[model samples]
Target: MAIYMDEIVKQMLQLSCKLEHTVLNSDSEPEEWVLLLDERQYLMKQLDEGILAGEVLSDHQKMLLAQIHGIDQRLQPIMLERKQGVEKKLREIQRSKTAVDAYHEAGPSAYGAFFDSKK
Candidate 1:
């Protein structure tokens, strides 16, 4: 049982390290981002399942905790970048909508007198 626990902890640690690497080296490609998020979600689900299963891991508790912290550290920057990207996209969409509305407001059907020469 002890050896099995150690192997499980080792595998979990490896996965955490891999996840951190993936997050740190992420690129601008959309598919890469999707892959990163998918990996994160999968890891999180697996961890949750393990916790729910009441498995007791005593040997590498501190090390696993540290790696989990490291993973969280990597998560912060990615989340911040995502927030900034979404905000920027929202600003762009708002700008586009505003321009369209302004054009419509100044169109010929606008609520105003028709074009007339002040001769």
Candidate 2:
């Protein structure tokens, strides 16, 4: 079936906006990156299917598809950067958790009584 590329275009645009926000200072969970990856893959598959079907395209859709392609090209590096940010944040959290575990393992005296030694 012929699908309007605008659907994919809007999806790509949203992804670009997300990448922008993710690159900025904010703590994003790993799931957020996974969502973005899924979106990208879905849009790519839609584009491929539309092309392979040789669907009749409207002028607006053609123009929008071109714009979407342009945005995708510009946003590739930003997506990579955001993916790195996500990975780095996940590692930091894991490392922090490990340190806390080690501190607690040192015994109740080190915790200043906030944690009961008996428990």
Candidate 3:
């Protein structure tokens, strides 16, 4: 039983590192990053569930958990950056939507009206 629990903890630690890398600075498309971030959350949920299921921890298991804690600490900034990135994206979308709405309300400006009619 303890061995099984130890194995689960090791898996969680690996997943934690995977998640940290996924959230690290990247030049990938936003949608790709979004998918990665979503998967990260799923991984984290699984880790939490596994941790909760373990009825008891041996000293070895505790050491593994300490490693997980270190990984989590390393992930903190990346997670916060992900959150801030999401907020910034939402704000940009809002600004773009407002510009589109205002353009419609004002109708075409002289520049658009002139170019829109012909060729």
Candidate 4:
């Protein structure tokens, strides 16, 4: 059970890292975000429960934990870059939307009146 749990934790962490990066790149859909958050929360809960239960880990599990820690460390910069890039994209989109909205609001005409009327 401990070994399985260790494997589960490793897989969850890897998925979390990937999803986090995706989110950072503005590539994460709402569903993906939810799934990633859920997995992270579940893994945290499992780790806490396992620790509280004083579970005995096999050698393989111990090794896996260490490996996961190392992988997480290596992923730090990638995670940061992804997050910053996503934020920048979102900000750019928001600024563009605001500018367009302002342009439309300043005029009496609706920007898409022609296309809407023809369709």
Best candidate (score: TM-score): 3
lDDT of 1 by residue, 1-119 (tens): 55555655566566666656655665544456567557656755665566677866574665776776777786778767866897899999999999667666644743665433223
Q: Lowest lDDT 10-mer window, candidate 4?
A: 110-119
- Model 4 regions more than 4 Å off: 1-37, 109-119
lDDT of 4 by residue, 2-119 (tens): 7757767777668766765765665556577667768877886887788778877668767766765675676577656766877999999999999777666655665555222222
* Model 2, residue 92: C-alpha shift (Å): 1.7
Which lDDT value does model 2 have at 91?
Answer: 100
Provide the overall lDDT of each model, using Cα atoms, as 2-decimal numbers.
Answer: 0.65, 0.70, 0.67, 0.69
**Residue range 5-68, candidate 2, lDDT tens digits:** 7677667767856754654434765477667768878887887888787866678767766775
Candidate 1, which ten residues in sequence have the lowest lDDT sum?
Answer: 110-119
In candidate 4, position 102 carries an lDDT of 65
Residue ranges of candidate 3 with Cα displaced over 4 Å: 28-54, 108-111, 114-119
Which 10-residue window of candidate 3 scores lowest in summed lDDT? 110-119
Which regions of candidate 1 deviate over 4 angstroms? 1-15, 29-34, 37-40, 104-119
Show pairs that collide, candidate 4: 24-82
Evaluate residue 117 in candidate 2 and report its C-alpha lDDT on the 0 to 100 scale.
39
TM-score for each model: 0.54, 0.50, 0.65, 0.58
